[model samples]
Target: MTVWYPQIDTSKCSGCGECVIACPNHALAVVSARAVMVIPQQCSYCGVCEVICPTSAIELPFLICFASSDNNKDQVS
Candidate 1:
């Protein structure tokens, strides 16, 4: 399944490109408007983008994780 992440606020952003350059999977890109997360499928949920965002635009989610061997794909958080 593919999930799309939220958009960044260009008004608050300073065009630092920190997220675009620091992305481990190269999923981010800078458009003519501002920086945007182009590919969210590569996100590892490591919160790297949230931590590096200077404008405090990134948000954290409480993910429900399941056991590695559960196989049922069930999760609760």
Candidate 2:
């Protein structure tokens, strides 16, 4: 199985729900005035949520393979 990790910048985040709604896979949620990913497996890496985030709060840290344990991919938020 493969997975992508998304980092949320709470400082930049303005409590907007765009990312939560933009996530096509329903992998996002709002928790305690903050955004969270409840289902990362559902992420499709479409970059939809990242694009809609007005504060640039959501970011894809890097592309990762659990079996290899090598992380070189870095994407901007």
Candidate 3:
């Protein structure tokens, strides 16, 4: 199964730590003065990090749609 995770853009990131603090799952961390996805499996695709990010460095691709698809698959089985 494909899972959606946040990918950080280093060039745009200011290492503000806003996304790190906002992530409920603690999936993000500061590495080399930039935000990185430290624990990808723990991410719930909730978009909290993306929303909290000030630099727009955190990109969540198809997170909601992928999550909904996973839920539908569970219901069908």
Higher-TM-score candidate of 2 and 3: 3
Per-candidate RMSD, Å = 4.7, 7.9, 5.0
List, residue by residue over 1-77, the lDDT tens digit for candidate 3.
67678888899999989988998899889998999889888899899988888889888887233334654775532
What TM-score does each of the candidates earn?
A: 0.63, 0.71, 0.78
lDDT of 1 by residue, 1-77 (tens): 43546456778777778877777888778787467877778777666777798887666555454565555547533
Q: Write the per-residue lDDT of candidate 2 for residues 1-77, one digit (tens) a residue.
A: 44666888888888778999888889888887788888887877788878899989988866633453236336322
> lDDT-based ranking, best first?
3, 2, 1
Report clash pairs, candidate 3: none
Score each candidate by Cα lDDT. Answer: 0.70, 0.79, 0.84
Give the poorly placed runs of model 1, Cα more than 4 Å off: 1-7, 63-77
Question: Cα miss at 18, model 2 (Å)?
Answer: 0.5
Best candidate (score: lDDT): 3
Q: Which prediction has the highest TM-score against the true structure?
A: 3
- Tell me the lDDT of candidate 3: 0.84
The alpha-carbon deviation from the true structure for residue 38 of candidate 3, after best TM-score superposition, in angstroms, is: 0.7
